[model samples]
Target: MGKTLAEKVWDEHVVRSTEGEPDLLFIDLHLIHEGTSPQAFDGLRLAGRKVRRPDLTLATEDHNVPTLDWDKPIADPVSKTQVDTLRKNAAEFGVRLHPLGDIEQGIVHVVGPQLGLTQPGMTIVCGDSHTSTHGAFGSIAFGIGTSEVEHVLATQTLPQAKPKTMAVTVNGSLPEGVTAKDLVLTLIAHTGTGGGQGYIVEYRGQAIRELSMEGRMTVCNMSIEWGAKAGMIAPDETTFAYIEGKPEAPKGADWDAAVEHWRTLVTDDDATFDKEIVLDASTMTPFVTWGTNPGQGVALGANVPSPEDFSDPSDKLACENALDYMGLEAGQPMRSVKVDTVFVGSCTNGRIEDLRLAAEIIKGHKVAEGTRLLVVPGSVRVRLQAMEEGLDQVFIEAGAEWRGAGCSMCLGMNPDTLQPQERSASTSNRNFEGRQGKGGRTHLVSVPVAAATAVRGTLSSPADLVPAGV
Candidate 1:
């Protein structure tokens, strides 16, 4: 049988294989952040071992670093220590570091692709769950634990069990007002959280191809939430275009040669996946997570689901618990739910395209009286580009706070956090209890939806802002 994309990539990168033993796969790149690298660096120090390939490694201070007042000392001592330790380790290990205030500094996943470091057919790993974001480039990228990070640093390779392949082909075109985020949320709702367990999912078909690179990244970024080991899309013309002029992209003859190789990185015509599923994007609509998990989502026009709607005991209990924590009742229109804050930034949807789209949606409209809106770019370069296009002014004029690039409001690690029992419509992924702060409630949304929610002070779609019969 012809090999699937995952099998092909895995075969090419296998360094050693032994019966009853995991295959040792080569790692093309290792991304680091303050939250997970400390212990990995510590392991190296204790072993008196140097990084096997410093050129293949990149480190940055994200997660726990303040997105605002970045120049000032970190007010939280623990956060300061983590950032400082990474700096010291990078210097000692001879790995390049992108500290705060550097144009390259941002979320590790965002920083990788912006610099053209992430490429097709490469094996990338980071000590962060969202590392799957890099898989949009057609690479086998996934998150690793701290111990695994240390292993990659010491050997430039990882021992991994080959994963089965699943094809998630989204056919047809996405309808107007729907987005990549909505599509992903829909996939999760259909497949449930554990649908892709032990498999690498390849998103394809007409709808996937129609999306821009940023949109593709947004789709792959949440693959982990679906319990996939990794998510990928085959390299195509759009992929080549996005990486063409990046800072680290190959130039002249090398560029042509690279593209030629990338073109071959697709599943064979006759290749069969271990599992396959298809979705129709034409029927999709703007979607939101009414409950805590990504799977607990419905169309914006739908009502919050009741526990009784589920037949499984575990599922019913989970729905009940989520409703209790979210302080929502069954049968309530999702659009009727109000919010205290709205955030538009994260590895999932903090690229330049996202910022521009959100800015356009909120232009000339003021944030609702009881709502707080924060527009944070994913990387310093994204921030600078947004500024060049005057997206900052549009957001500022809309009564939103424009902040520097970082993983702000994505987690409780940084200073940007939700107050107790405060609910927010956020573009960031993950809405687990206390994910943003203690007793906080988070509703995952697309950037445009988030912008519209800010203006309406409720769960809303951009179309909601339009006049009747306009």
Candidate 2:
């Protein structure tokens, strides 16, 4: 029998495998951030161990770094301590770190790919849940806890139990207004929050193959939202072109060799997945989360679902609790759900492509009277490129705040948070209670939906503001 893509990658990286014991897998890249690395680094020190492969390890300050006034000292004492701790830890461990204000400094996931450090057929692990984002390069990337982080640091290998393979096949082309965000949201809704538990999903089919690398990243970034161990798409020409000439990408003969090897990373024609799911992309629409979790979403025109709509008792109860927390009612139209703030950046959708999509809608347009829009780039490089293209001016003219790069408003860690009882249309991944701020209700949306919501001050899409033609 042929091996699946995940199995191929896993088998290559397996240093030791026992029939009844966990496999010892070698990790090629270990990315770290301030939020989760401090404890792991401390544990290493307490145990008198040094990072076994500092050359393969990288550290950055993102979650705790303030997007505003980055030149100045961080005001939040706790945030400052975490950033400072990572710097100290990186320096002591001989690990390369991209500190705040560095051109390379940004969200770990964004930085890795933008720098060409993440590539096809590699085993990438990070101490962040969204590490699955790297799987867009056809790598077997996943998140690890602090204990596992320490273990990887000491041995550069992780003892792991292999996950089952799941094939999520998307056929047909996506509608013009629909996006990968909507497709992934719809997939989660179909599968439920815990649907992919114990499985690593490989997205395939014509629709998946046609997406731009950025779009693929957006989908993989949210795999964890559906409880998948990881998400991957086989590398192709699009992947090669994106990595070509990138700073860390292989060059000359190395580039040729890398491409030749990457070409073989796809699942064999006879390979079989443990489970299979097929979705028709033509049937998808712009999606938005009506309740707290990502699974509680509907098409842009859908109404908030009533608890009675669910056949599962637990699902009914979850819907009821989500409604109460979200201050929403069943039968309410999701399209007109009021929003106070609009955020357009996160690891999930904070790339230059995402920015351009939002800019296209905001150009020659103005934000709604009461809505505050924040247009944050995912990285300093992305922010600079946007400025060069004058995308920043487009947002500014539209009455939006064009901010610097970082994970702003994606989570409640930074100062860019929603006030109590406020609601926001965001392009981030999660919508769990208080994910953005205390008492702040979040509606997960695509970049187009977020941009239109900012213009209309409600849940919306570009089709709502711009007619079919000029």
Candidate 3:
């Protein structure tokens, strides 16, 4: 049988197999962040063990750092301690760390790929749930809990059972204004957030092949939302081009040899997946979440679904609860919803490309008078690049609060948060109840939609804010 990309990468990284047990796979990269690594490091200390391969691990402070001030001390005691603990742990374990104010500091997922540490065919593990973001490079990456984090730190290997494989083939060309965020949200809606259970999904077909590396990352980053163990795309020219000049990428002859190996990473013509799904990208549009879960989404032009529309009893109950939590009226046009805040930053959509897209729409406009708008970069590197292109100026001139890099507003770990009873149009992933703050309601949208919402103080699309031409 022809092997899928996930199988090929898994086979190459397997160190040993035990009778009647899962293989002990070797991990090439271990990523750590402030939210989950403190306890893992404590476990290692109590056991009197040191990191087996510090060279293979990297650490950064995100999730708990204030985005508004890079130099001031963290105001939240719990958040401050988390960041302090990570720094102490990294120093004691001889692992390199990008502190809060460092130029390389940002979301762990964003920093890994930008630094060239996430390579094709490598096994990557992180303490963050969104670690699957690295799969864009054809790597087998997944999230690990704190216990698993300590296991990898002590042994440099993980005992994991192989997962079933599924193929999600998106064919045809994506329409204008449709983005990776829309594509992923649509997939979750189709798959019901539990369709990929017990499987690693491989994204294929012409539409996926045409996506840039960053876009691919955006797709794979949300695999977990669909119950997939991981999601990956085969490495190709787009992947190679993105990694060419990265700090950790191969050089000279090594680069040439690596490309040759990556060329053979694709699934064979006859390869079989445990399951397959096909989607037409041209039919997709800007998607937004109307309910608490990512799967509860509709196209921008559609109305919020009434509970009666759900045929299944369970689904009907879920819809009722979601509507109550979100304070949304059934059958109402989603575009007419008002928002108190607008956030555009997270591991999922805080890249330079995402910032550029949002900036393009907000260039000559100002944010709504009563709305709070925050524009955060994904990493220090992204922040610097955006400044070089004057994107920072454009955002600042639009009356948006230009902030430092971190996982701000993606979750409530940091100081950036929505007040109680506040509704927000956010570009970040996940819209679960209380995700932003207690009693805060979130609606997920694309970068352009987020920008437009900032301008109008409502859930609006870019088409409504900007004309077709400039």
Candidate 4:
């Protein structure tokens, strides 16, 4: 049997295997954040152990830092303490630290790729669930718990049972108005939330091959929501191009050698997967989640699903509960559903390219009356790039609030959150119940879809709002 891309990468990273026990795998990189690293650092201290490979570890303050007022003290004491502790720990452990407002500071996942720390055939672990975002580079990246973080700090390796492999082959080109976000949401709707359980998915086929590195990142970023241990696309020309000039990427002769190795990272012609799924991209449209879970999605032009449509009693009950919490009517057109807010930022779609796409659509369009819109950058570097391109002006002129870089409103960990009963069209991943805030309804959509929703104050697609040329 031929090995899939996941299997190839896993086999290469395995350090040792014992019968009836999990294999000990070497982790190439360990990413840390303020939200989860505090206790792990403390554990290492109490155990009198030093980080085994400080050079391979990195830290940043994101989840708890305020987006505004970079120079001021963090207003929330708990948040301040966490951020402070991370800095102290990083210094004590001899790991590189990107503190709040630092040019390199941002969401850990975003920072990894932007800095070229995420590369093909490597094993990356972070404390954030969206660590799968790094898998876009053809690496095996996944989230780890606090204890696991401590373990990695002390050992620079992880013990793991091998996961099954699944292939999500997206064929054909996507429609004009569809996006990576829509494609992922559509897949979730088809496979349900638990479809990829105990599996590391390898996205393949023509459509997957056509995606940009950022687009691939967006697709893999939500794999956890589908219950996948990790999700990845094989390295190709596009991946190489994106990493070519990155600071940490190989240069000169080393660059040529690295690309040569990355070239062979693709699945072989006869590679076999444990499971396979095929999706047609052309038929997909702008999609949104109407319920708490990421799987409860429908096309923008479609109607909300009724619980009775589900044949399984469990599915029916789940749909009913989701509908009740979302306050959405069954069979009601999603386009006509009003929104209270629009948020455009997160590891899933908070890059410079994402902001540019939304800004292009929002150039002359105004946010609907009474709608609160926020445009946050994923990191300080992304924010600087967006400003240089005047994306901030375009958003501010369109009546959207432009804020600093951080994981804002994505998990409600910061002050940026929705008020009770406030419904929002957000570009961030995850639409779990009260994810944005207590009693806050969330509808996950693409950047363009989010831009159009802000213009119309309802769930909408950019094609419906913008003209043919302008």
TM-score each candidate. Answer: 0.99, 0.99, 0.98, 0.98
Weakest lDDT window of 10 consecutive positions for candidate 4: 461-470
Which residue runs of candidate 1 sit more than 4 Å off their true CA positions?
466-470
- Which runs in model 2 stand beyond 4 Å of their true positions? 466-470
Candidate 3 Cα lDDT to native: 0.92
Worst 10 residues of 3 by lDDT: 461-470
Q: Which regions of candidate 3 are displaced past 4 Å?
A: 466-470
Off by over 4 Å in 4: 466-470
Sorting all predicted structures by lDDT, with the top scorer first, yields: 2, 1, 3, 4
Give candidate 4's root-mean-square deviation (CA, Å): 1.3
Q: Please, what are the lDDT tens digits per residue for candidate 2 over residues 120-173?
A: 999999998999999999999999998999999999999999999999999999
* Clash pairs detected, candidate 3: none
Candidate 1: residue 299 lDDT (0-100): 92
Residue clash pairs of candidate 4: none
What is the C-alpha local distance difference test score of each model? 0.93, 0.93, 0.92, 0.91
When superposed on Cα atoms, how far off is each prediction in RMSD? 1.3, 1.2, 1.3, 1.3
